[model samples]
Target: MIKTIIFDFGDVFLNLDKPATARELKKHEISNFSEAMLQKNREYEKGLMTSEEFVEEYCSSFPQLNSEVFTGSWNAILLDFPKHRLEFLKRLKREGKYTLILLSNTNDIHIDWVKENVEFFDEFKNCFDGFHLSQEINLRKPDAEIYEYVLAQHGVTPEETLFIDDTSENTKAAAELGIQVWNIDPAKEDVTDLFTIKKDLF
Candidate 1:
């Protein structure tokens, strides 16, 4: 019996524009964002580096752009977390039908942005019994360790959990570990759509 519902934070609970960083860099006359630059950003996401450090390193390399501006631009991908999604998750929590969890492969900078911008961070945190972040855990999706860690921590059986994520690769990884997953397209569907099809989830 599906007892847990895990949702990915970015591109699922909240909006994330993957291309925003490259776009923002373009505005600063940084036309060539090398693969190495992207790797640095991912390392930050994995908690291997801090946001302040990232800004310093990036600004040092660019030398022309202000580090604060770089920080804001790096954070531009984080748009708004709509009220409806928060309400939906809260409703599910109130129902007490499933163990609601929020899992995301995210970083310090983006989290800092959310803490500052999303006033309801406490409310959102209150809704989830388990909030697993890749950085804090030092484990990320597409790797079995993350899924294994979550399942172990929650005592949840893979067959009895439904994982929803915006990234195709992430959902695929969870599914490989035996958790039912939905690779949702936010631009194509919304949160309400999941509840409507809940009966077919198992």
Candidate 2:
């Protein structure tokens, strides 16, 4: 039986334009992220670097772009949070059948944008019994340690937890640790149909 539910924020609950950031950057003549740039992004997501520091690193690399432009492009990945998803989550929270946990790999600037743009952000956050943001916790997903940390912190057995994410890499990582998962495809499905889609689990 699944006693706890772990959800990924991007695409699972909130909508995202995954290519928007890269597309935006290309417009500024920044076509690709080098390995070092990617590492910096990972560091930022892990809270190893401050937002200011992250922005400065990018600005220094691309001297033509200022902090504001880079920040805007970075945040272009976030789209809208559909109201129906929030309603489904709220209903699930009201039922209180399982321990609800939100585990996301996100940076400060992205979350700051979410807080400002998503009107019901606070209410959505309150639905979770445990809300673990990667940057806030200094841990990001697709890593065994982060999943272990969440399980230990919440005192939930991996076998009794269901992890839902849009990324297959993340879902595969959790599955390897004995946690059940749904690697949802946002293009074909909506999370509101969770129960029907994963009926055997329920």
Clashes of each: 0, 0
Candidate 1 off by > 4 Å: none
Question: Residue 148 deviation, candidate 2, in Å?
Answer: 0.4
Local accuracy of candidate 2 as per-residue lDDT tens digits, 1-202? 8899999999988899999999999998999779999999999999999999999999999998899999999999999999999999999999989999999999999999999999999999999999999998999989999999999999999999999999999999999999999999999999999899988998
List clashing residue pairs in candidate 2. Answer: none
| Per-residue alpha-carbon lDDT of candidate 1 for residues 1-202, written as tens digits (9 for 90 to 100) | 7889998998887888889987998888887867998888778767888777888889988987887888778888999899998998888989999998888998887888899999999899999989988889888887888899999999999999999998888989999999998888889887657866666774
Candidates' TM-scores? 0.93, 0.98
Residue pairs with backbone atoms closer than 3 Å in model 1 (clashes): none
How much is the lDDT of residue 1 in candidate 2?
88
lDDT of each: 0.86, 0.94
